[model samples]
Each structure stands twice: as structure tokens, then as C-alpha cells.
Target: MQRVRLVDVARDAGVHPATASRALNPAVVGEVSQATVQRVRRSADKLGYVPNTLARGLRTSRSYVAALVIPDITNALFPPIVRGAEQVLTEAGFTLVLTDTNSATEVERSQIASLRAHGVDGFIVATASWHDPLLDELATEGFPTVLVNRRCATSALPFVGGDDQQGVRLCVEHLVGQGHRDIVHLAGPSNTSTGRERADAFRAAMRDHRLSVRQTVIECSAYTEQAGAAGAARLMARRRPFTAVVAANDLVALGAMDALGSAGVTCPRDYSITGFNDLAFMDKLTPALTTVRVPFTEMGAHAARRLLEWIADQPPTATQSMLPVELVVRGTTGAPPVD
Candidate 1:
């Protein structure tokens, strides 16, 4: 089968190859008139024209590819982010390469090195530890990198994520409004920013509500369901007098539910629970989960766009872009059960 070429598109559009090239090129799409751009785009679509990314990369000294490094690809919270990023990158004529580091620092470093060796133009990392040395090194080396749904200790690099502190506050407030005064928190790992910030926020929010934080917070080793279950079990073993649990993420909340059920506790009947991330299928659960909804898709899209701006030698207007979050009420949260 004959591959469609730029010349054929230009011929069909009644324009020179150079004009069609400019019209089709994402980088210079603005240089051409909107009418001409529309015409050339229509012609290219009709001819099924696919740009030769390799050839274009060689000419521009760019791979036209970006790497999306995440902690765990299986986590449902990340798919929406990936979709959003892929959409923006695709529109910009760039391909997105996804890599999961399994929350390992060395693995993440090796993945970054491998992607760089393969000539990826930039990176959108969602696996940043609070004090990641690899990310610091990337910053030192002036790599075009954007952090999504996470941030480093230092504010040198650009990041896009939700307002973790505010999100936790909303969850706490909602539980409090439901008359849940004795609430426990299922915190995530302390190593990552999301874990640390959300945990800290939980404490602060609890304190702000004039509630005691002591003996009410249990940190999970990781964000996985296993960690959440263990945390919940530990909290239960302590015989803590709490009527609600605020999990750091949806996975943690699910784990908490598992633990509660095993202990013969019913959600919103014997106990109320709130989760973060508002991940997919939360509503479909036997008792719909009440969670904080982060703008995962927007965060991903913003990170991709920011990376593109950096790759184009344009500095971002802001160092950190924190999107807003909302508390999603569901069947899992209600007024505390009468003892």
C-alpha cells in the first residue's frame, strides 16, 4: 500500500508542500492562516496523511515523544490522568510513552535513563518521592520535566496536582457535618508527597476542627489495598473509639471497608468512611464510597501542556498548579450510628 505523503496533501489542498507542512505542523500551526490550516487539515484527513515523526524529529532535534512515569500502572486513579495527557500530547503531534516504576526509586531512575537514552523529549512524572534525588538531578541537568499528582520537596520543578490539604479538609468537614466526631485516618506512605501532604492535612484538619489527632492516625506502608487493610486492622486492634475512617485514597478506603466487614461492621450503619481520589467504580460498590474527587484528567492534561511549553523553551507561568477538589457524598458516609 502506498503511504500518503506531504506532497500529495499539498497537491490536494492546492498549496505548496512548505505551506502544507507549516499548516500541519503543531509547532507552527499558528503561522498559517486559520482558513488555510483548516483546508490543509481537511485535505490531510481525506488522504489519510500521517506525519513522519522520525523524519520530523531528526530535523527538529526532538524525539516528538514524552515519557509518563507513574508509580503503579494498575492503580485505577492513574488511567484518567494518562488519558488526559495522551489526548493533549496527541493533539500536539507528540507521542506519549508510559512507564511504571512500581514505587521503586532505582527502577524509576533506570526508567528515566532508558527513556532519555531513547531520545524522549521530556518527562511527566507522577512517581515523585518527597525528596527524590533523581528528580533533583533532573532539575540540576535542566531536563524538561513536569510532575503530575505529586511534587518534590523543592519547588524548582513545575508540578500539577490537586490541593491535597484542602481536599482533606473537605473530607474532614463532611464527616464532621455528619456528626462523626470520633474519626480515624488511614494515611498513605510518608515517602511520597501525596502521602505525606494528605496525612499532614488530615492532622491539621482534625486539629482545626478541635479534634484530637493522637491515636487516630495510622500510616500505611504504601497506597495499596494490602497496606490499607493492615492499617485498618492496626487501628481496630487499638480499640480506638472512632465512628468514621478517612482513607488517603480510594484503594485505602476499599481496604478499610474490607477490614470493617471482616470485623462485622457495616458502612454508614455502624461506621462512616470517606476516601480520596474518587476513582472509578466507587459508586458501583455494594455501598457507594464517599470520596474526594481530584481533577485527575485535568492534572494530566496540564502536566503534558506544561512539559510541551518547557520543551519549546517557554517557562511556565506558575511553579505549581494546584487544582481544586470536591467531596463526593455517597452511601458509605452518614450520621454516626447510635451506640
Candidate 2:
């Protein structure tokens, strides 16, 4: 079918094309009679006349293509964020072009170049390392890029991250409340902001609680299940009489759980544990993990919104967006075994 034009609706409604156009759009058409608005809508529905987003975008010099770049989509934490961003972008008359770097630096650079070459209006980036040279390179181009869950040290780039301090505070406080004193902190790779922030938060919370948490911090290779299991095993053998574990992320915590199971140690009876990001299936495990739930969806959507500001040639409202986090109390943490 040929593209439905406003003229068709105007001819059908016996009104001028401009009047029909004004009657159809909510902004200018509110002054038109409600009956006319309803009629235009009815005609539009009957004709299956969906507005052409590309034509409008081209006229405005806004291609309406938004880039959503992630480190790895295979991780359970990303699907919800993508779904939420797509919902908001669709309502705003924008298109999303997703790219995955698969955690490779060269691939990520190539992806960025491709997105920039394609004339994407802005970017919502969910991947950041402490020493990300690619982001610094992108920063010079004046493209609107919002970082999510990770950030560069410089204040120039905008970012959206979880309230990691609060999340770790809750986990530490919960462990303290459960009468644990010796806890192991499973630190993630320090190159990422999430890892560093959560690790720092755990230490601060522990000290603030006045708990003598004899901590043995082991840095994991990556936020992978195998790394977590290996780190947990090392901590178990290396630490002396530790009663609880606090992992930087949920993936690490699950790995720790597996290591503990292999050793035939019962969770909460022999030791309690905590994790972050509260991924799906956390509760279904033999002992449901107590974890922090970050607002990844809200952060993703906010990044999209901030990127729009860049596309509009306006400065982002804030350099960083810190979404709130909540602690989910589950089966993993409990009182230490009595003396």
C-alpha cells in the first residue's frame, strides 16, 4: 500500500489537510473539537496509518537511531535492561541498534566505530573498565554517551550506576545482625567501577558497624562463575574460622556456593553468605542467596534519556546518575555457630 498521507484523511473527513493534521496530533490538535480528534483517529486506525518515523527524523536531522552497547549479553543481568530501554525508546519514536562486544577490546572498538559511522544520535553504554581507553577516545568526538554500571574516573563523561555503597552496607549490616564477625570479601576485578565500589562499600560498612570482621579479600579473575568458585575455595582454605562470605556480584556468590557444596559445608549452619545484583534463579538454589537488587532497568532507561539530551545539543543534566538499590533478605545469611 502507498504511504497514507494526511491528505487522504482530510479528503475523507471533508476538512482541510492542515486541519486534519492538527486534529490528529495531540499537541496542536487539542484546540480542535474532541469529536474531530476522535474522527481523525478512527480514520487513521481504519487506514492502518502508522506515522513514518524515519521521514520525520530525517526532516529534523535526527536519524533517531540509538546505540545500546554492552560488554556481554550472555550474562543474565542484561536482558531486562535491554527490554526496558526498548520500551522507552519505542515510545519516544526512536530506534535501538544493539551491539555486543563479547568482552573483547578490539571488538568493542570496531563496534563503536560502526555505530558512529552509522550516524547514531546517541549511545547508552553498559560496559566500562577503570582504564577504558576506548571511552576516552569516544569522549573527544562530542557524541552523547552515557555509561551504565561502570564509569571512567574523569568527570567529563556521564554515567549511571547503582547505589553500591548502600547495597554493600545492607549486606554487611545484615551479616552483623546475624552475629557473624569473621567474613571473607570476594572482590571482583578492580578495573570495573562496580567491583571497586562494592568492595570499598563492604569494608566501610564493616568498620562502621564496629564489627571486627577478619577479612581475607581475594580478587577474582573476572566476574565469572568459575572465578567465583576458585576464589571461594581459596578463601575457605586460607582464612581461619571465617563464618560468612560477601561477594562483589551474584555470579561470584553462586560460584562460592558451588565450592562450599563440594566441600560438604552447609550454608548458614557452617557459614552464611551475601551476593550482589540478585540475578534470576537466586532463590531457587539449595539456600536462597541474600543479595542486592540494582535498578538496572531504570539505569538503562535513564542513560537513553540522557543520550537524547546530547542528540539535542544540550548538556546532560548530571555527570552521573546513581540509581537506588535494595537488599533482598534470603536464606544465605545467618548467625554464626555458637562457641
Candidate 3:
């Protein structure tokens, strides 16, 4: 058997071998005419031609691969993001490698180092903290990295996320419109941008509605169910009187609901709760959740596109990309119960 080569495809497509090469290389395919690109691709397919990526990498000094670093693979919030990113990368003739650090900085550092040694072209990272030294370092070293679903406080790296302030404002307005006067907030970790921005936005919204902001924030240690449960427990222990709770994310909301139910408190009857992220199956909960809908899939796709632009030597026009959000009304929220 003989191996198919670029010359064979070029001969069959009636184009030069150089044109065939550009047509096959996604990074430079746009240099050729669309018709020629299609013709070359068809010829390659008919001849069972496969580009030698290893040889191309050696000549171009690029692996044509991007690494997506996330905090947790099992979190329902992340699968949509992964799917969106993979689709864009595959279309661009780039391989998408997914890795998780389990929310550990040390593990993240090690994984990133390993990927760098393997010649990954760029990174789409979703595990940034508000004050991440590693992210700062990456930016200082001129790495082509984009942050997804999270952002650093002062790092120069580009980032894409939902408009946290707008999302919180929508949640607050919805709860207030339903007559939730005394609302408590289950905030995420102060160390992450999502947590800080959402918590701050909640305060601003509450103040706008003439509600006292005192004792409204219960800071959760992480964005997990366990952290949500612990934060709810602490709020209960404080004996605060509130008719509604605004959770930072959907998982936190679920944990809070479980904790409240254990103490014989039911949603909308005794308390109203609103959550962020509007994750999958949120509408199918025992009492369907009212949450802020973030377009996570779009967010992921946008981040990957941004990274590709950087890899192509095109600097982004802006440092941040904030996606819009919507308030999803469900069964979990209602007018405050009679005192």
C-alpha cells in the first residue's frame, strides 16, 4: 500500500501542492479560495489522505492543540462548556485537551507545567481565582491564555463570564418584586471573582430597594454543595429572620434547600430562594428553582474563539467579555409568607 501525499491531492484537485497544503492547514486555510479549499479537501478524502501533524508541528513550531483547564470535571456546570469549546477547536483543526485540577492550586500548576512541556499552543482556563498568582505569572510570561467562567482581579489575561452584577441585579429584582423584604444571601468564596461580584451586586440591589444590607451575606467556603450546606447552617445558627435566600450558584441553592428541609422549612411556603447559573434540571427540582440563566455553552465557545485569535497573533480588542443573563422564574420563589 502507498501513503497518500499532498501532491496527489493537489493533482486530483487541479491545484498546486502549496495551495493544497494551505487548504488542509486550518490555521492558513483562509488564504486559499473557498472553492479550492473544498476541492482539495474532497480530493484528500477520496484519496484517504491524512495530514502529518507531527511533521507539520516540527516545521511550524506549533502543536495545533489547545488545553482547557477546569476545576472539576464532574460538576454539571462544566459539561456544556466543554462541549462548546471542543466544537470550536475541532472546526479550527485544533485538538482540545481537557484536564481538571479539582480546585487545587498545586495540582493546577503541575498540570499546566506538564501541558506546556508537551507543546500545547494555548490554554482556555476556567479555574482562575480572584487573586491568582499563577495566572499573573502566566500573563507576565506572555502565555496565550484565556480565562473562562472566572476572572482574576488584576491579571492582564483575557476572560469571559456572565455579567455577574447584572445577574445578581435580576435575581434581587425578581425576589423584591415578589415581596421578599428580608432576604439572606449565601455567597461563594471571597477569593473568587464570581463570588465577590455576585455578593457585591446583591448588596447594591438590596440597597436600591431600600432594604437593610446588615447580616445579609453568609460567605460559603467553596462553590460546592457541602460549602452551601455549611453556610446555610451558619445562617440558621445566627437566628436571623429572613423570608428569602439568594444563593450564589445552583449547587449552593440545592444544598441550602436540603438543609432547610431537614429543619422542616419548605421553599416558597416558608422561604423563597433564588439561585445563579440555572444549571440543568433546575426546573425539575422538588420545588423548581428560580435562577439567573447564564449561557455557559456560549461562554465556552467565545473563550475558545478568543484563544484562537491570540494563537493566530491577533490580540483581542478587549480584555473582558461579559455574556448577558436572564432571570428564570420557577416554583421556588413567591411572595414572602405571612409573618
Candidate 4:
């Protein structure tokens, strides 16, 4: 059998090829008559004519493609998130382009420029920093942008993340209730909202619970296993030893666990440890990790939806959503062992 073309379908449907093309595009669905649309659709089905997305988009000024900007795709936490985003966008007939800048600002800038040159319909940026100049420029340039799992100091952009304040409160309350009054929080860099907010929440939660934390918080330069190990070591070097450690991220917590192991310490028995994000392998560690579980997949789906809205020129109201978190009780957390 021979392949079908738009012209062949349009001729059978008693419409122009351009009219048939518009009917096939969801973005222009409203402009065409429903009866005519059904006719054109039937004709298309009979002919099995594949719509040329590139050609149609040239006529309609749409690419039906979105770019996802990731800081570090190698992180285990990102796979599920990307899967969720792609699942949603795929249903909407939008192609998702995954780009990693390795968390480098310069690389991110160049990549964003390249995506713009390719004419992406919008962007879902998962690498937002506190003061992201590239993000601001993109937003100001009127490109539809959705920030996933991070935020900027300025609230002009749509942001999605876990409830940091609530998650921290729950974590601190759990630690204090477990008889861990001397707890250390392994924090991320203060430059990003997740790091800054979680750190501040830790301080507030500690104060609210009347826990006396005698040591300074350990802020890792980046959210990586190596950084976590280094940061945990620094906290241990201080003169005072805390009975528990609450890590800002799972990698950091796992790193802290490694550091403790290297120093001949045991978790829950020697010092209770808790982590955030409940990433993969948390439960399979030497002692299962007790960490907060944030809905990474949900955040990704929400980001996809938000980006679609922008592509449709129906941007959501500039707002921030803080999803709920669950604290998983595992082997890593327990009552402070008797000295």
C-alpha cells in the first residue's frame, strides 16, 4: 500500500491541506468546526496520513517540544522525576528534550541558548538557584518556564517543591521525641531554596522543641555523596559530638553514614541518622535509612503540566506549591544509645 499525504486526505474531506493540518493540531482545535474536524479526522484515518509536525509547526509557529534543564542528571533522584515529566508531556503530543549542564551555570547558559535556537515550546528547569540570572532572563523574555524542586528568591516564577518547613518540623520532632537532644543537621548550600529553607527550618524546629544544639550546621558545597562525606567529616572534627544527625539530602545522609562507619561508629546504636528524599538504595544500606519521602514523581508531573500551560499561553498564576512529606521509620533512626 502507498503512504497517504495531507493533500490526499484534504481532497477526500473536501477541505484544504492547511485546514486538515489545523484540525489535526490540538492547539488549533478550537478554530476549526467540530463537524469539519471529524470529517477531516475520518479522512486522515482512512488515508493513514501522518501529519508532518515540522511542516505544520512552521505554519502555526509551534514546535510542540519542551526542554528540561537538569543540574545533575546522574543523581539517582532524577530518573523518576524525568519519567514522570516525560509521561505527562508525551500524552500532550509534546516532545521532551533532556539537557544536563552538570550544575554549571556557564554550561547551563550555553545549553539554554541552544535550546532557544531550536525553538522549544517552553522549558521546565529543575536546576533553579536562588539567584538564577538565566532563569530570570528566560522568564522576562516571555518564555513559558516552570521550576521543578527548586525556586528563586523572587516569587515571579511558578515553583514546585516538597514542604520543607513541615518536613523539617516532622524530622526534628521525631529526633527530639527519640531522645536526641544534641542533633546536628547536615545541610546543603544556602544559595538554593531547598538548602536555605531546610537549614532554617532545622534551626526553628530545634528551637521549638527546646533542643540545645551546641555545634554549627555543616553546609555541603553541593548535594553529592563526596560533598556529604566531606561535610560530615567536618562536623565530626568539632570538639563536641552530637547524638544524632539529620541530613538535608539522602546523598549527604548516606555520606554521613559512611563517615561514621569509617570512624567505627554505629547508627541508631551510637548516633541516630535521618535523611531527606528517601532515594533509591536508602533501604538497602548497611542499616536502612529513616528519611523523609517527598513525591519526586508528582513534582515532575506538575512541572510538565505547568510547562504545557505556558506553551498554550495559559500560564498558571505565579504560585509555589509545597507538597506533603512522609517520614519513614527505618533502622537508621532509634532512641539514643546509653553512653
Scored by lDDT, the top model is: 3
Residue 284 lDDT, candidate 4, scale 0-100: 93
Q: Which residue pairs does candidate 3 place in steric collision?
A: none
What lDDT is obtained when candidate 4 is compared to the true structure? 0.86
Q: Compared with the true structure, what per-residue lDDT tens digits does model 3 show for residues 208-246?
A: 999999999999998888888898899889998989999
Task: Give the lowest summed-lDDT range of ten residues in model 2.
Answer: 21-30
Better of 2 and 3 by lDDT: 3
How much is the lDDT of residue 67 in candidate 2?
Answer: 86
Clashing pairs in 1: none
Question: Which is better, 1 or 2, measured by TM-score?
Answer: 1
Off by over 4 Å in 1: none
Q: How well does model 3 score by local distance difference test?
A: 0.92
Weakest 10 consecutive residues, lDDT, candidate 3?
Answer: 311-320
- Model 1 lDDT vs. the true structure? 0.91
| Clash-forming residue pairs, model 4 | none
Q: 1-339 in candidate 2: lDDT tens per residue? A: 588887787777777877777786433566789888788878888877776657666667777889888888888888877877787777566889989988788898899888888788888887888888778776876667888888876536898778888998888888888888887789888888877887888778878877654555788888888999999888878757788889988999888888988998778888998999988888888789899998878877877777766776886644777888999999988889887
Local accuracy of candidate 4 as per-residue lDDT tens digits, 1-339 = 876888899999999977887787776667899999999999989888877778767876999889889999889888888988999988776789999999889999999899989899888888888998888887777788899889988647888888988887888899888888888888988889999999999988998887764564888998888888998789878857688888989998888888878998878778998889999888898788889998999999988888888777797777898889999989988898887
TM-score of each: 0.97, 0.90, 0.97, 0.89
Q: In model 4, where do residues sit more than 4 Å from their true spots?
A: 6-49
lDDT at 301 for candidate 1? 96
Cα lDDT tens digits for candidate 1, 1-339? 999999999999999999999999999999999999999999999999999999999999999999999999999999999999999999999999999999888899999999999999999999988888888888888889999998989747899999999999999999999898999889988888888898899999899999999988899998888888899899889987889999999999898889879999878789999999989899899899999999899999999999999999896644889999999999998999886
